[model samples]
Target: PGLEVSMTMLAVDALLDEVAENRAHIGLAYNPPPHARIAYRASSAQPVVLLLRKDHPLAKRGGPASLNDLQAYPLALMPSTFGIGHVVSMAQVAANVSIRPTLVTNSLSALKRFVTAENFMTLVGEFAAYRELGSEELTTVAVAHPLFESAQARVLVKADRPLAAGPLELLKWIEERMPMFAPVKRPARRKPIR
Candidate 1:
């Protein structure tokens, strides 16, 4: 939460690049797990992934969110500064459709604030919006296909050494509270790109 984090939100591939070079105490924070392993040792974080917002047409699409259905709308997205671009890549593969976001911003808090009456859709970390999702302000959208398997969010210690004192303490805290963590999830199918 402080400067020690260096950078909190980064594109996963770039993060991997850093870890490969022994640059950062890098770990991937993902709602869905990646199939291939990277150059770092891995530990996991529980996830509370949320499919949020209602009346946003996506739910009203009635049947499942088919590729054709997804094509009809411009999505509201977190800016490329955040992982929304990565999320879109994941979604593009899963939904078998390309998405052009109507808007993008990096702020999770801002995204939450903006979704009030907009039909925008976003997949977020479970902890990120637990209160609202629990209160039924949002609902988890079920996808017909699956992408990620068991592993969820990943925590990587820098290559040469291990996570030290304070950071180690934080990791332990996360592990103890793991139940609140949501396992990485995916739609049943990784739709082929068109």
Candidate 2:
């Protein structure tokens, strides 16, 4: 229990490089591109969703939003430096749909603030707005695009590197707790046999 751990937050590209070079013990990445030196310890589907205020017109519809639906709103987005932006760009190209964002920034807080303070919308992974979703102010609408359906959030480490005791233990701990961080739908329980 005396392990000293240091954490650094990096963009997806830098995070991959750090783990591949053994400069970091672990990295959490979203929709990371394949790298020969990296090994995925665990992964979960992390679909891109439309983040907007609860009172947004799309939110009032109470259904999945489409790329075309985004055209009506002023869109705020993260720059392509982050994985969410990168994936969104790729998906847009693959789907042959282009959206011009009104504001682009790397700050998550700024994105959240924009959506709440104005009628603007942003695209991000649902986990990014998990806390806000629990409150009444923010909500996410699932995006109805095939390319966005398969994005993954991954836990990664250097391939062939044996982790030391503390790091290994920490890795295990993270794996065990991953589900708590990422939402998963569990089947409803049935009544026990009568």
- Candidate with maximal TM-score: 2
Candidate 2 to truth, TM: 0.88
Please estimate how well model 1 matches the true structure, expressed as its whole-model Cα lDDT.
0.54
Task: Report residue 156 deviation for candidate 2 (angstroms).
Answer: 0.6
**Residue 101 CA error for candidate 1 (Å)?**
1.1
What would the TM-scores of all predictions be? 0.61, 0.88
Q: Taking the tens digit of each residue's C-alpha lDDT, what string does model 2 give over 4-113?
A: 99998788888999998889999988888888999998888888899999899999999898888877899998878778877778877887888789999878899999
RMSD of candidates 1 onward, in order: 10.7, 2.9
After TM-score superposition, what is the CA distance of residue 110 in candidate 1 from its true location, in Å?
2.3
Clash pairs, candidate 2, are none
Which RMSD does model 2 reach against the true structure? 2.9
